[model samples]
Target: MEHVYIGLGSNLADPAEQLRNAVQALGQLPDSVLVGVSAFYQSDSLLPGQPRYTNAVVALDSDLAPLALLDALQAIEIDQGRERHERWGPRTLDLDILLFGDRLIDEPRLKVPHYHMQARPFVLYPLAELAPVDLQLADGRTLKALLADCPFVGLERLPH
Candidate 1:
């Protein structure tokens, strides 16, 4: 099984519940088993003047191909009322495949490690939690070193 990381977020109605439902949907996918999840986090929106977002990371063991996993994620988002209007726009749900066992791929539709994941504290914080055992840096640098340098001022760990 290939270990994969996914970034989860919701800013629409019932954002917390929406995130919970997404985790459930992801757990039920064929050829995939939910391994663990990071604590939920609250962060300012990437888009200005938008509602704050609830973010989390999910660790999974999956046999699905990267593109196929992307398709599944798209379906999950659409089911939760996600619509793409502008870049970095708001959404009911957002699921991003962050990594696939260190393999790198660049396609018009996809980029391994998700193009901008490294720079986003919302994503990096949760990812660091989900895989605290090893800092698997998408960059050659260590995840531990990266975490130390990140200033996710707007991010806070939610109460359990």
Candidate 2:
């Protein structure tokens, strides 16, 4: 089984509840075991005029292939009322496969290590909680180094 990290976010329809439900759904995935989940966090929307988002990271060990896993995540998003109307627009839920073990994937439909993860505080801080202190991406960047460059700004940790 390959260890994977998933990033979850929501800003519509009771954001926090959406994440909780998503976590439950993740635990039920076939050939996958949900391992760790970070504390929920609230962060300002990347785009102005949108509601702040609730985000968290989850760790999973799965035997499923990368593309198959991506498909599952997308299906979960759709099942939770996700719509594909705009780029980075507000949504009922957003689930992303942030990292897939130590493998580097560059598929047309998905990118491992998530292309913008190193620069997004919402992704980095929550990920830091579940990832190993010496975690290194397939691209050779260390999690500790990424955290040093990314500041925890515009984010609030919600009570568990």
Candidate with top lDDT is 2
lDDT of candidate model 2 versus the reference: 0.96
Tell me the tens digit of each residue's lDDT in model 2 across 1-160: 9999999999999999999999999999999999999999999899999999999999999999999999999999999999999988999999999999999999899988899999999999999999986999999999999999999998999999
lDDT of 1: 0.86
Which pairs clash in model 2?
A: none
Candidate of highest TM-score: 2
Query: lDDT for every model?
Result: 0.86, 0.96
Per-residue error (Å), model 2, residue 4: 0.2
Per-residue lDDT of candidate 1, residues 48-112 (tens digit): 89999999999999999999999999999999888999768778999998888777768788887
What is the TM-score of candidate 1?
0.93
